[model samples]
Target: MRTRALLTPLVLAAVTTAGLTVAAPPALAAGPDISVTNTKAHLDQLQSIANANGGNRSTGRPGYKASVDWVKAKLDAAGYTTTVQSFSTSSGTSYNLVADLPGGDASSVVMFGAHLDSVSVGPGINDNGSGSAGILETALAYAASGQTPRNHVRFGFWGAEELGLLGSKYYVGQLTTAQRSAIRSYQNFDMIASPNVGYFVYDDNAVGNGVRDDFTAYYDSKGLPWEYIDVQGRSDRAAFRSSGMATGGIFSGAETIKTSAQASKWGGVAGKAFDACYHRACDTNTNLDLVALDRNVDTIGYMVWRYAAKDYGTTTPPTGSNLLANPGFESGAVSWTGTSGPITSGAGRPAHSGTWKLWLGGNGASATESEQQTVTIPSTAATAQLSFWGRFDTAETGSTVYDTLKVQVVVAGVTTTLATYGNVGADTTWVQRSFDLSAYRGKSVTVKLVATEDSSAQTSFVIDDTALTTT
Candidate 1:
């Protein structure tokens, strides 16, 4: 996940010149001592296997299969229930190695994953052997050290990732709708570090900017220079994010070069892709900068330990005020008013009654012209009270249908049916729907409303004064 830059000719030129001048140097600061004797040992094993097979751990290759077995044996020895989820593509059969260290909320999980397959080009030593080695080391360290993470921590070693995040995509797709909802987050280590050096962090675009701030805080605190890069599906993190999970990872530069500007910010030679070997055959064990690799291992390991373990504290419940309040000029909320629009209908779908025209809000929320808008309440609240105003027109034909509506709170996509109201048939007046989301307590919710439909479907409905009050 860690890497940066767009390769313009100019950028390349700058990197080449700067790289020649700035030799890959190791970080002076000492990383916490994790017994990586095993990590180093595993690296050697992977190297030997790679060297034995024409220096390649290509997918479907014997060396790759051997690598999978090696990891499986280690997990088994560590008392993890190892399972191989296999799939096939045009290339060949690939495997995703999953092992569970059941703990904490069995339902809520924290996943730690890395890709085990290397590029067909060479032993793929630095390309991923490094990541595989690091993860193997970390997992074994956790087992040997006798430290238990509070949350159910799952480990995965993906295959065919170099081919485009295939393993992760397949894994995420296999989860039942219910299983997907229980995941807390995913921490990925694609390339824990590079012997080539430089530093950067992977950014998941779906997530808010808070992750970046968290990284800055950590790097700045350690006086370590780091850069940020957009995450490409080149790794497993991208796949997790695609499934709506939050993701982040550390990297020590790759084939992409650091710019003068980046170097100034992160203190690396401007214009060099953090690591020179990248995917090349030269990406051997010797190419790695132990200093950079060591620091990254410690930095990421600690972060995983802290967040995945949930050591910070329990999340607080939303307040009664926050729950009862509605958004408006009073609560600093923005209003989205719908104008008259054509009504469409279709057969019943899972989440919708019929076909509909979806209007996405400026904030990226979907809404209908006749239905109420959706609001996402912040998680910081202790107890929240949500209130909104809805004006409905129940003027119908043969049936005496009520001008009713439904309000719901969706926490992490799991909807909580809150309240349903009938505005009294034929009533074209605004009714207040006050719902106490206190049951959600510590959870954040995306508020949703569906106005009841009648034969006399109105052209449009107006909603205003939506507020979520926090105690």
Candidate 2:
């Protein structure tokens, strides 16, 4: 969980035609490395905007509104539902930008937030531009990924945070009880790119929920040392934590003196403040640790992807004569035997007919994921056909067969790969794939879809609208 974007990649190519240049959309990264270049580009925008508006985007200031407008425009263009929530402050009126991915369970929302406002004294690049730009790029990348999530994903850019977290407090104060409860998890990020950074995950023990575990695990996986920091009643997290929503996030230390041991572990000055600039005029683009900025933004992207497909292992009872339980995944992950997070009702990709589908692979790493169900065909049936609609999207090209989706059959625990689909011809159209099930009549068999991908690039396999019919 972390914060801030809108899109138009930094290095996108264009075909110029007499001052009418059309820029091509940049190819999206599979996950995590959702383009550090894009994140930095967003920070560049924030820096320039601050420069044009009195060196700061403090609450109720012209630069703050410009920041909100800029981020909203990007999200709007990328298809997120954007809203500018205005609140009154002592100075004047300030704004918060909220953006949501279109689909996912409305009852449970996973949110990533960062304060967009800086202090009146400086540009606040590392103080928060790191976080703001990080989240914005993450949002834009999610829009480009086209994988719908299981839980609703929202991004918030708050206002007046430097003024004692007033913006987030005000925003939460306005939510109805039901609306507040709906935001099941909130992750706050502030000052993530200190010049001398210390990776710290929020730990209130009672309010972090399990998000801290995920955050710690991610750090461990990367071999990055991290420590738990108490952020309760501090920063924007206080607003959500006090509202009964579970809260957690990471903070690169701000204004704290670096200890000798911490320096040895994380590498930087031995005793200087983690972020020497903190909120001063020197807190410009030059004050950032680009390495920390890239890594944290990548982590932000990873977390968003994780929560988007998070499944709580609950499902609805099978209905109708389809012979498959929760075939479309609309009722969560009912009757599914493989892969914990693939059955998604996300709106990023079109389902065959409904709001849910079985998604596998596209993690951008060497991975395999699948979904399966077991059923017995009646012996008396004259004909039995197993069919489903499937669609595919990929970052791999040119027929080398980097990723593959195998439709398999398991009879008496003997697995057989029935058909193998690859990235070369896997289009975004919903095409029917069928296999005769007459051979398995009077016997129980497991129908499975297994997707495998190499370490680079991603290929997503989406399946839905299944039926097993006999007459």
| Model 1 stretches with alpha carbons more than 4 Å out | 1-32, 208-214, 261-270, 311-471
lDDT of 1: 0.59
Summed backbone clashes in each candidate are 39, 6
Worst 10 residues of 1 by lDDT: 329-338
lDDT of 1 by residue, 162-270 (tens): 7777888888876754356556677777665565466666666466344445554566557666656665655587767777776777666667666566666556577
The Cα local distance difference test for each model comes to: 0.59, 0.78
Q: After superposition, how far is residue 67 of candidate 2 from its true place, in Å?
A: 0.6
RMSD of 1: 15.2
User: Poorest 10 consecutive residues of model 2 by lDDT?
Assistant: 7-16
Clashing pairs in 2: 3-135, 4-135, 4-136, 5-136, 6-74, 148-346
